[model samples]
Target: MESKLSRNEAISQLVLASSSPRRKELVASLDLSLPVYILSTDTDESIEAHWSPEQVVEQLSLRKANAALDLLQQKQAVETSLIIGADTIVVLDGDVLGKPVDDDEAKAMLRRLQGRAHEVYTGIACVLSSSGEAQLAHRMTKVKMKPLSEEQIARYVATGEPRDKAGSYGIQGLGSTLVDEIEGCYFNVVGLPLSLLSDMLATYDIAVF
Candidate 1:
């Protein structure tokens, strides 16, 4: 456990290493009461293509965090900031589905996921810039999509909400209507996992409350 921050010093320096708007919104709502700084890192997301979903998310999350930290150091901007990096992926039948590259690919991913259950795995990493100390973790959520007719899928796809999302769905947006039930962290499917994030921050002298 870390020492609690004083109200006078409560607004800790934070760097979120992600380009994801969904993740930025989710983290903002936590109200860590810190001076949050959002960073969009263009980290290489490619992997071996054969790694398990868990392994892939974990490695990618760490890479994003480290990449952001490196950038900060290069700029000599922040040495004591708490850095966060994360990645989310949809897995079905052992295949990892990342953000779709185009409308057609998004449609194909949605077509395959409809009327079926899939897993959303989100990996999170927290690193202290000063000490290079870090902790990493991941959460898995089971999401079951409602059976949709060709018309329903086509209409949803036409709306373009699925274009940039994994598995061609955004649970926090129009895609909510497509999910029948979810068996894990709701935020994980939305792009970040709050409970998992809160727990990780505890080690860095930050508290969500």
Candidate 2:
């Protein structure tokens, strides 16, 4: 991947189009110190029954990147900007569980997730506004949750921590207590798959180290 990056002559244009602090921290952890700029566009995350989990996240991430690309072009910065967008979703038993709508919903989501292993898919998309070039990929991690009683689930939901997270929990925060084990990239469940993003960034000549 390093060799491929060298071949592209390197791309210095970097921008993030997300409001997620978790993603911001994940990106900063690379030591890039890059600027994060949110896009003016909003996405409707409703998924169709026909789409696979990968398709759901890939489309959502690409939509966000495209929105950011549009914003950059509006500012006439298209040629000099590389915009990134990412989306994550939790899948259990072929069902997609997004962020909870309320505390009750959060508890319900957690109840179904307890004692079960679910697949978390995070999609990352990078768009070079110059020449309208784009690349998108999705990574999946299997996360097993510790069994929880109704009381435990209700308690976690009442903390308001799970309301804003997919699958009603965050593996990188206080919610980490609920996870028993993870089968793949740990950062993926946190919101961004750094290793996967590093490789994806390489295709655009963006290096992390």
Clashes of 1: 0
Tens digits of per-residue lDDT, candidate 1, 122-208, equal 999887787666678999999999888888888998998988888898999999999999999999999899999997777655779
Clashes of each: 0, 0
- Per-residue CA lDDT of model 2 for 135-176, tens digit only, reads 789899999999999998888787888878989898887889
| Poorly placed runs, candidate 2 (over 4 Å) | 1-10, 33-40
Question: Which candidate's TM-score is highest?
Answer: 1
Clashing pairs in 1: none
- The local distance difference test score of each candidate is 0.86, 0.82
